[model samples]
Target: MTQEEATRLIGGIYDSIFDTITKAAPGGKPLMAPATTVLSLAKPSIAITPKDFRNPWTPGNPTAAGIQPALNTAALVDDAIKLSGLYTQSGVGISEVYGQVMDSVHIKTQAPNPANDKQLDDAFNVLNRKVEQTDPETGEKTTKTVESTLLTDYNTNMIAYNMAQAVYTAAYLEAQKTQTGRATWPMLAPNYQVPVKIAYDKWRSNFADKVEQAQSIMQTSSQNALSKAFKYAKDVFESYGVTLENVDKAMSRKIYRSTLLPSDWYSLT
Candidate 1:
């Protein structure tokens, strides 16, 4: 299932189960009641035994599984629920008694599969590095961090990479169109005769700018790798007495469009 659906399903299941348990308890208040204070005065209790709650095959498995996992999944959820009076009788709200619970759950819930882990990991790595940069005007640090494992999944990573490729391809194509049929001078010869030297210089400057912008979209490592490959190509072209400028002109003339889909990256052998 999609990540949003999975999150909502898990969240809904937990809320439903919590509602039922609270209603059946002797002095338990409705789970949705707003508290006068953030901290609850009464301790809460679990209606079901821990073992039954943890088991996968039990009839109460879905509800129990939801609650048990949530206890350790997030601090806000666990802290609020555990500190309430739901678990006790003196002042029943919800469980206010605190205790350690299992931090992970193993159930049959359908969610994004484990195969997408590598994709999620790579995406986070890129985002982490990107976040460390300082904003130029404000000098304030800006970051966008997401903790979901599904973010690194094949689907998401592919989306990011494809976006980068599309931007790169568009810029490169525009550069190529502008550079078409441009004459090249062998050197800065004193006797060089060109009709419009200033125009040539302007075109060259714009081409450089576009290339730089395209390269900037990539992460540092990816940019470095591509630069290294291009350098190798440059050296080979130089062996034929081709200048670096001429080589860049030739390479930019070729348009490269990626045809690979995201699913192709994750296809099993």
Candidate 2:
């Protein structure tokens, strides 16, 4: 048979088998697209011209114009027939086939803590500290003493939190396959439960490290903001000749009316 004919024969057989299995499955439908492998006949051609009997001494040099058996069909048939079995298995919706495809793709889901408010708080704390720093040599102070409202924007922090949650969730799901007393599924027989658990544990540890890193950043920012606020308060107190007690009194009064001022303020001076 020609190579093209062999390819068609094998492909048709595999497709038939695949359809049968898909129909038998619980859903009675194929989960994926049908796959096909095609083999083309090798057509080796040689051109002959009226060059005369220039090389009459050459062996098999027929001085005639006719078609030659230039294609090899046997090898093509052998290979195509052998590969048909693989195609049939793939079409049957085997776990190995689907697992390979799933492994290559990532699915996103909602995080347990979608807001990541804690992580945001930590990040803000860290950034605030840096913003409040005063260069000892330059004697230059930060323009803003406190963190801006912009720092509390939750979008960036939520994304980081979600990424960490994804890693954790993936690890957890992988670990659940080996839970005690669970019936072993035929598809997962190749892998031991212990090894999968170990891998997932490692994944969880890495995710924790990422969360800590994020929290550390926020802590530093918060410290910076506190430092800036403290410095600003100290400078104001020194300029006004006001004692800490007077400052507290001023803050406690709801209105600046003289009647609302503390009675002991002048005695302290």
Candidate 3:
């Protein structure tokens, strides 16, 4: 989902919870609600669990469907993705940027299955390096990298390693800045762990036992939804290159535009 949409959804949820509590209170005297980390709620886990072969968000809900591997070299992936975005936004070929990143990193290795973890790590070592070259005659040296190039490009905006993170950051920032979230998401100047400690305390002292009764229903549903979304994203993104689907373009065209039903429905009658 677009960051704005997720922000709205999360905001609505927070509002609903507050409203329900307010109405249920004895005399409308609002209970002092404790501010909690709003990070986890930025994009709550999906409550609709997808089945084995039944993709819940196949061609639909493209914004909500996306995947990125949990990896050690995620930074490398981000570097490439951001560079690609810089190129894409400026009307340049994404492939050109990818090639540049690969070359500078000294990535001479190739993997048959680029999606594999081992293979990605191999390429990561290369892509994660600084660009360098040495003059043959004069022994002069120079270095260049995508980040350096990006810094010089005037057209660069919304830098991101990949589309999914780009979208997530927008949503995350919205939640962090929202009125309700500011108190909850801030860093404690003196103690960084204050919020974390409070969260842990709250979970143990009040929330955990209360969640048991609804676990099956909430847990099952969310897991299913997440599964489908994750699969759809992986299907549309390749570890080594540009996204398989351009979400905006794909969502724009009419699904049945090519159908024999024809443009004029009255003609069938």
Candidate 4:
């Protein structure tokens, strides 16, 4: 099989599983679109916004229906990458799947604390000292006093605060996951839970045998495609009197060089 064929197969299987799990509501309206347009290691980057982290799972919350499927999509995509051995070969890891998690939910940037900012400002004002400076270019000494330490102190404080804020933001986002799927708990008309649960039970009853088999076929076909491409590229370069050594030099050059190695060429080709 070719790479294109493998990609199509993977997408088809994913669509089948997704559609089964997220069957339409009673009115023939879909709860939401699929989590993604495509499923691939090189899928488009997901944009994570602030709202995702805070959306409530309460009944009638429109956003909640998509959350579980989005998370599951990320997991399945990551599984596909691992099974295909692409992550190992490309230096990409399962962490890429985490992008889907973050994207599916909203996370607000931590708001700056005015009191903390004031305290930091006050501390810097008291601790900062003046220093005498000379012009290095002219080798001329001057009686100029500068608040050099003050700027440095302020920057250091900012860095510390930013790090703390990052930690807080990550924690908040993680907490949101605990509430996933709760939106369907109220069991309103066509509550997503009943159909989704029924579908999942049916799918898992066979241990997801179909998806597993398709993924296995994809892995072999993708690997074979890569090998064929690699040989073609090697042949083209050899015809131009370019050796592997030349390719290595091109890859390693400081300027006008590729960030990829020859192995990466296999995937790109």
Candidate 5:
């Protein structure tokens, strides 16, 4: 996306997570909670378990209605998601910015050029030019030229490529600031890890095991729900890019939205 779009995305991500946590926690205590806090309340003891989804073929089971709530609970304790909040507030990390740059490069390479398509070329040539319009209800065959508002796949793709290029530029600038020393490729610079190691460490040491168990339980629940002819949960899961249809392609991308600034690059320096 463009620098402006990227900025907006980062702000939106921050606001979404922070605001949601604020509303969920009493007096917004979670927002001020230390990154090291284990958040034990998110542990699997209270979450949906594999036992809850047993017997997929059983009649009158709650498997179909429970997938979403289980997934939501799993997300609450996800390390990557927790780091996303810190990532937004800390101006993101070096690896995250580079990941976005890689995505932009890939998008730019895949975008179809207008020159490759004759019809699209012709359409773009007269994109802003006048086009004839007809008034069908007036029973008048009078033709008047009006500005062409036609948008084609080529135009849409080029716009996406331009926005991606803008993001690439922003990422490059971010890399220049985050890089520790000279490197052949600035975008591929070192220290590609998250900025706050303590947060990750705390989560791993105290919460990873329980969270993983909870996620496993939720995954089992999702699979059972999908297999039990739960179309609603299947459709909802697919909307989030998760599908039992292709287990290999469940999570296509990992980099999330967050701004970049050297001053906010804590611990990584």
Candidate 6:
């Protein structure tokens, strides 16, 4: 399928899934309007913030939900480039995913603790170190140093980073099985952004908490298949929108099956 179709399918799924899951709550509402309204990844919404497992006060962590509004909608749109860099867009192996975990751990553990790290550490470091000013009315001269707010990765959290990689790998592998080398994930969509993120965080949590239990919920015949199908989906589409089901149907009705150079167990096309 084309990128637009892929995007739409994911969006529809998000819109539907959120509608369903939120309904189970006492009085949850749709986080975003719909796909048509919030049109592109360039303007995706942070409808629901995932729980930041690592930082507990960052975007990926649900507990840190309050921190998101600091960006506002305009800043959210502006920060797309920085946000996208959180994960490896391309597919990777278990070792790579593990490495991602380690990388995040290292970043979060930075000494002086990250934030623009704005302070010039050099003994002779200076940013307007010598400031001078003259009070015209008082005819007095004064000089002082100006300090700059150090900017570190504002949303730095090892858990979020590693979880992002896990989500990326799952989405990429699923795309490989379902749509060639496509990287058009609904998580990257505007309307579907929240639901997709929630789904990913849930998957990550489930995997972390109870891995063997994945087979029952994911419906994969084998543990390996569960890994390739991108882990956990028991009934995401069946419960909400039929977008995923439709993708499979489209593959079956239109695209002919063929042997792949290096096929994963879950893929036969």
TM-score of each: 0.13, 0.19, 0.15, 0.18, 0.18, 0.14
Looking at candidate 6, what is the lDDT of residue 3? 100
Please state the error at residue 82 of candidate 2 in Å.
Answer: 18
Q: Weakest 10 consecutive residues, lDDT, candidate 5?
A: 254-263
RMSD of each: 29.6, 35.0, 27.6, 27.3, 26.6, 28.9
After best superposition, candidate 1 residue 176: deviation in angstroms? 1.0
Best by lDDT: 4
Cα lDDT tens digits, model 3, 101-167, are 4444432344354345444443333333467889999899997544332222211221222343444
Over 92-178, each residue of candidate 5 has an lDDT whose tens digit, in order, gives 444445444434432113345354344443433444344456678975555554434332333444455556556555655665664
For model 4, the stretches where C-alpha displacement exceeds 4 angstroms are 1-147, 180-255, 258-269
Off-target runs (Cα >4 Å) in candidate 3 are 1-196, 209-269
What are the lDDT scores of the predictions, listed in order?
0.39, 0.42, 0.39, 0.44, 0.41, 0.38
Stronger candidate by lDDT (4 vs 6): 4
* Candidate 5, lDDT over the whole model: 0.41
Order of candidates by lDDT, top first? 4, 2, 5, 1, 3, 6
Model 6, 1-269: lDDT tens digits are: 99999989877875676465334455655455443232223335334332321122223333434333322221322222322312222343333343344344321233452332322232113212456899999989998765321111112333555566666667556666655345455444444345457655654544333322322333433323434443233233223211111345546211111222332322323
Compare the candidates by TM-score and give the number of the best one.
2
| Residue 234, model 4, lDDT | 47
lDDT per residue as tens, model 4, 1-269: 99999989977876776576566867785545655433233344444443333332222443545344333333333432434312223444344343344334443344576765554554444444455568999987766434444344444554555565565455545545666534433343244334444544544443344334443443444324455455565455334331122246657311111122332222322
| Candidate 1 local lDDT, 76-97, one digit each (tens) | 1223344443332333211223
Off by over 4 Å in 2: 1-11, 20-31, 34-131, 143-269
What lDDT does candidate 3 reach at residue 152?
26
Ranking by TM-score: 2, 5, 4, 3, 6, 1
Runs in model 5 deviating more than 4 A are 1-132, 146-157, 180-269
